[model samples]
Target: MTTMTDTSPREFKMPDVGEGLTEAEILKWYVQPGDTVTDGQVVCEVETAKAAVELPIPYDGVVRALHFPEGTTVDVGTSIIAVDVASGAAPAPASEAASASASAEKAAPATPAAPAAKPAPAAKKIEGRKPVLVGYGVAESSTKRRPRKGVPATAAPAEDTLYAAAAIQAVQGELNGHGHAPGGQRPLAKPPVRKLAKDLGVDLATITPSGPDGVITREDVHAAVAPPKAPEPVVEAPSAPAAPAVAPAPVASYDGARETRIPVKGVRKATAAAMVGSAFTAPHVTEFVTVDVTRTMKLVEELKQDRELAGLRVNPLLLIAKALLVAIKRHPDINASWDEAAQEIVVKHYVNLGIAAATPRGLIVPNIKDAHAKTLPQLAESLGELVSTAKEGRTSPAAMQGGTVTITNVGVFGIDTGTPILNPGESAILAVGSIKLQPWVHKGKVKARQVTTLALSFDHRLVDGELGSKVLADVAAILEQPKRLITWA
Candidate 1:
């Protein structure tokens, strides 16, 4: 019989869960050191640029250590947790068996080789490794909540150091008459509220408390700073000569001689490379057009009440995507990309429409595959899913690649219009601006209409100016009359 060696002590590294997202903050730990975790179980909650994501443990093992503390930030591909796999674990529970079978069915040819057979001694140990419960793993045992800072049940010098820092800041602020007076002192408010007061340029000592314990509530701060109403017009005498304006004190500079550094690990690093690649490689030309999209806005309001579109987010973006798809069909060349190394142009037969998402981490364009094939309702669903996934930082690598054309919704951030840089490998990107009420001359009469600006940036090498203009005009026409999309499509 073949002998098998124990495959214990597997380190679970943080995976690149989304499109080039580099770092994530641990929101909560689902498993602690010494806890047993089963394969495919949620081991922790982590916050990325997109959203809070639950990370699943990939091995059935005892958690050897938590490499990083909860609330600590860690880079992608770093080992966050380590586990000691049980030796001879029995086949996983029935549920896991069923899942494994399903996965096997879906897997393509050439799956990895199965684990080796083991001797009786190793088999017994492996059997011990079998999880006691079913599903991912037993839920972590609950314990009394521990304070985020200060003394812990376990004595540690680091905790004392943090406490000292807090104390020092408090003592210094007191000396400067900036913080609350000492002890019996006054209300019991947290440090954050005090910081908020400082930022708002409010004198916390002057504000009266309204809370049960005389604590100053956030509302109290707002009321104190509320702007005064317009005053009655008053005749005023000429003011005295203004004092010589001393140039505003130069803002305090950082200690440049004693250099401080921020490691480029996450979004900053990813954005730099993507922007550089796109700027230099793509031969870009931008064109702008203004359109009256009053009809499109009306249609959006109508769709918001429709039962079919209920629960799914219905926004101007959905219509914008639809118009772009229709326009691409009419002028297919605008959706084509230049392949410089191949000395050719790739005109994609199907549209994998990329929606440029501005995430906290950076700009990521995760595409909806075969978006051209999806119906309006289906497209809406896909768009919602794409954005939700992008925000949560779970957009897969596959979703970030092979985009044919992109749309940057700058309007969401209140931008009027911009010449968006093309997403690398994509031929065109359309910028959608904020819709505002503007006066327009229509049919010899000036009227208030909902207006928006559309900016289209295309690779000049692949898309001629004429084709680019046609695409923009087609999209504008559809928005001007929503019904035009149905006829054009």
Candidate 2:
């Protein structure tokens, strides 16, 4: 109920927690209004399209207000919390009496074009600071927030007006087309909306965005698809007799006893969109191979006993991953991405090997950087860390980007194998089946051997049958002859 006139408060805007992520759902608040917080203390956890991230308050202060409650999906750069750091100085007794008697308009502060800029002294504090989020766009700490010209000092501050201001500016820009910021960037729209516009053959630059902040929306896209027509013919039909009313069907409640509807959002929604885009956009061709990996299994066990890798993870997945990397090295052309815009096949020189990990929230594929260059021990360490981080739901968005190839170990769930859709922007995905003891001829005699099935799916536009087969065959060959890892690698 108290308003501070002595100091301007600081606002913690929602950071772009991932690459180009537009919005995030606030899941929980660790600190409420009136709670004291120190620098780097986590204040909230938000679920973005990629993952849930805990945002740490960057300075010491007492929280003035929580702008939005939990579960609000707020756009990035919007102030979500307000904090005051006037060295613990309480509001003056006279100011308190005035605040009590003051009208709402008199207490309301002027809205800054941006955040209440952080003081310049904290610059060195974050100078060497590495990003806590992997691949997330961190909001820059500002040294100044230019107040709109002619606003009086006595005017109160608007702590929660980030989205609203952007919207007003965006609308103005839309009305006056070609209104670009100092640095001319295109209008704002979600990736899917852009994709939809592309699919519908609609030009986004030509359309006037009706969404908040002049962002293009799906409805706007569909509207663009429909042909414009002159006002509908005004026909006054003779009054007709009303028909007898019929009984209507009762709609089922989402919260019914047996049925529950979960809102499509966060990682699952992103995964779905990516899957759909991959499936329809790219011509997917899946190939399968059943192999006896008894030797590979034995090698895995042997690696576990080795002194160097004693504490690291040693499993079929480790060997499978190594085998795939070796295969990619042999058939380098198979490791590529199809760039639709450039109309070129981008063959990557290095491998960002993605390991698809299933978590409580959703499935995430975090990759190991320069995996092709890693030795067996180094690869094992990275793989172990990737799995642990993914399972704990702490995997960074950066770890999932720029993957040239991916591996989904569906065998862990006891499934034989699956034709996994390619991860968006990647050429292929390999699915590993369950390693089981099955009857097979290993030395020209029927005997029990560790057998498994692998499914490789590739973008048909880039990978021809011969090339895809070579990659799959090489992976199988390495697993069939585990010693080949030494010879081939």
How does each model score on TM-score? 0.58, 0.64
Question: Which portions of model 2 miss their true places by more than 4 Å?
Answer: 1-10, 31-41, 58-65, 83-256
The best candidate by lDDT is 2
28-74, model 2: which lDDT tens digit per residue?
67678898866544577577777665566655679999999987889
- After aligning candidate 2 to the native by TM-score, how far in Å is the CA of 41 from where it should be? 4.8
Q: Report how far off residue 142 is in candidate 1 (Å).
A: 28
Relative to the unseen true structure, what is the Cα RMSD of model 1?
Answer: 15.5
| Candidate 1: tens digits of C-alpha lDDT, residues 8-93 | 46666776554566887775676778987755445775655433445655446788888999768898878888887675442232
Model 2 weakest lDDT span, ten residues long:
170-179
Clashing residue pairs in all predictions, respectively, total 7, 4
Q: Distance from true position, residue 118, model 2, in Å?
A: 14
